[model samples]
Target: MYQFNFNFEEFLAEYWQKKPTIIKGGFKNFVDPISPDELAGLAMEDEVDSRYIAQHDDEWDVKHGPLTFDDVPEDHWSFIVQAANHWHEGAAQLITPFRQLPNWLMDDLMISYSTPGGGVGPHIDQYDVFITQGSGKRHWRVGPKREDYEEEFRHPALRQIKSFEPIIDDVLEPGDILYIPPGFPHDGYAIETSMSFSVGFRSPKKQELLSSFADHVIANEIGDVHYHNPDLPARQCSGAILDAERQGLENMLRSLLDHPQLMKDWMGEHLSNNRHELDLIAAEPQWENSEVREFLTQPEVLKRLNGLRAFYYPETPTVAYIHGERFTLPSECEQVIPLLCDHEEVTGEMLGEMIEHPAVIDFLTQLINQGYWYPAE
Candidate 1:
């Protein structure tokens, strides 16, 4: 299943970011993560968010629903469901290979099924996503890019759909993939029954960027420079802060962003931190004096949780951050970081004679205590 084909990796390395490239027959032996019936069942459930849009001739009607297979009108229009990443483990498995991408960069998987003539119309996304064509055919119309987009008020809920004139139009077959970079306007219409797994990546908007920046301003004393107060009348009731105050505030803000550590910390938190659990364990380190060589060298195993992300943060110095919690390890333990980043099961024997390293033993103990990675008891 992990066979990396020459062409696939080549496409990723070369044309992934530069241009749009379609890979035909990428998922060999590609058993679907979820069957069409299973997905249809998910659509029927009340807790799941699902919607369908139909186009009869030129008229487009969209409706939100707890849609079942029966509610669908035999053909013609697109059905979209969101947050499959949160609900269906099977749907989520489609994205398992890309875990090499940090959770910060990787967003979520959204699988959509389109019947004949079904499409969401020409639309543009601000974030990068890979649309993996599954099961049937979908015709895609993609433009190089036209960012000066005009959006009109359609529904108060969704942001207005973008109008695009496609430069490239082609029908994608099963096991084909379409990579659409941010700002590219494209639309996909199903020629027959089709399923597409959209692997999306998160990008921060201006407001989110500003919020994190503001947080960095207050958390660290990067913005603590005092504002100069010129001598003024005691009864001054100026609504705004004076020139010196403004300059000081501007300088502080600049200093906040200018702080070398600001972007680094923000990136670490943004990328390494999971949207889910990151519980920090409070247990004290236990292997400092104990010669646990036997314990480490024995048939020991490290268990990996489903959503765990174990990354070594160089900035945090002697700490390995896993699932957003900081686990401090000894300085000599740096080599052990890769072992954790492997994100799969590893035994003491596979860890080899390096188990003699006190630092490695200590690191394993801390990991076990944190439950970020646990011993296979």
Candidate 2:
């Protein structure tokens, strides 16, 4: 039971939802999730989403990914990579430690390496991001949450500005962390050759939130309540029949939504679900379920998956939802769910404590049955 030595608990208590706070040199011996060469290598891949912003002479040039510096004019552009979290094992590891929340509530990390005068311009992201200054220096300008959000059609020649104004501006050295809440407009430019790791938490929008739930219902994983059509004949005319049907459908949906567990179900499925483009690195000859259980039973051995994160949406008092493998867990062991979620070191001591609860042990046993749980090398 190694608690985080960092003041995350104090931070969550004081300023999580309040104004943004800066932690001067918060990360100690913080290594860049990946090196510039590694990022460049990933950018050269055709499938990954990467971009570069060439901003000089008051003009901007932007290009999409699987690109190298040779792909663009190599003067003043900075490399911006998306879904870097998915491709790079280290970038993914950077975020796994923060799996206190559900996976659905979590999002991917983006990283960039920039030359002098390179920047993406002032932009507002739809989700939250924790920008870490990895190497060199970047000047970050931040603004407050603005009103009057403007949506443009994204003209090819025009610069798109999201709602953000510069309220705070400073130079970020290595290990300096900048936390930006959603809808806060901010911009960063490199003072020199700088690298930044953006750890983001992208919560769902209204449409996405609704669609995810709808998809889950259609999949028949949750909301077992049947949409019973009243077996009444067409006594009324066409107009009356349409109105009655609408009312019945609406009422049925409302009833399903009215359950106290509806939100929990949605959160669970969302958080515990796997990320896109999962790269499962297998080891040695495949072992059977029996071997998996035997491996898990070892007192000194620990079972952890490489490049995998497990998060639980622990909303209900009786059960929890784990991401990646997608399974239910005992609510009593909620205190330990994050250990698995972070994809960090998991100790036999922690498992022993959790297995003390018969239900939790049973659930983990089922995971072993599925070969999702593996012993650490």
Candidate number achieving the greatest TM-score relative to the actual structure: 2
**TM-score versus the correct structure, for each prediction:** 0.73, 0.75
lDDT of 1 at 371: 58
- Candidate 1 off by > 4 Å: 2-9, 12-14, 41-70, 81-93, 99-103, 152-154, 160-163, 216-246, 261-263, 274-310, 314-317, 342-345, 350-377
Query: Residue 114's C-alpha lDDT in candidate 1?
Result: 83
Q: Cα lDDT of model 2 overall?
A: 0.67
lDDT of 1: 0.67
Q: What is the lDDT of residue 156 in candidate 1?
A: 44
Residues forming the 10-long window of minimal summed lDDT in candidate 2? 316-325
Work out candidate 1's RMSD over C-alphas. Answer: 5.5
Clash list (residue pairs), candidate 1: 77-118
Count backbone clashes in candidate 2.
3
Q: Write the per-residue lDDT of candidate 2 for residues 115-142, one digit (tens) a residue.
A: 8878877777777677888888999998
